[model samples]
Target: MSRRSLLSRAIRSNGEPIKITIDKSGANTSAINDYNDDAGADIEIRQNKYLNNIIGQDHRPIKQLCKATLGFGRFRTARITIGDFESMRIIRKR
Candidate 1:
């Protein structure tokens, strides 16, 4: 198989979304960093990698990647990232 196909298969094989916390400037900070300290361009690179994986996986819903559960009862629920769910003040859909 081609390298692209192999890489795509490898990313999909994980079966887990790499949880990422993106900063206001669109940098993907580390999950362990509560302060969201600026880590420079590496953060953006990591975030892009995770995003690429997600897209490569065909946007499959992976529970591990879900940072928030929204809505309840007759509402359209969704799983969101930690940063968006908390920092952005998004209410739970469920």
Candidate 2:
């Protein structure tokens, strides 16, 4: 009998691009405070406890771990978190 592995992965996301800045002597401290409040390091740690899981040290598309067969209807997927993918900014790709 063949065996399959079921791996579980967890991801935490806050939708936004991270901005970096230098703390040089600025002319405006208020602006700096605002920017700092709105920005910081965007770090994500996916924990996978199963083999072939997306969160393992070596990973694949987390979305692939999820299986869904869409048929006879339009499929709308949101915030696909299983992969190391870019943001869906909803801008024109063409």
Q: Estimate each model's TM-score.
A: 0.18, 0.15
- Give the alpha-carbon lDDT of every model: 0.38, 0.31
| Residue 92 lDDT, candidate 2, scale 0-100 | 23
Model 2 residue 25 lDDT score: 28
Q: Model 1: how large is the Cα RMSD against the reference? A: 15.3
Which 10 residues in a row give candidate 2 its minimum summed lDDT?
Answer: 2-11
- lDDT for position 67 in model 1: 26
- Clash totals for all models, in order? 7, 1
Which residue pairs show backbone clashes in model 1?
Answer: 70-93, 70-94, 71-92, 71-93, 71-94, 72-93, 72-94
Q: Tell me the tens digit of each residue's lDDT in model 2 across 5-90.
A: 11001112434323322233242234434434555534322222343242343323333444432222322343333221333322
Best candidate (score: lDDT): 1
The TM-score of candidate 1 is 0.18
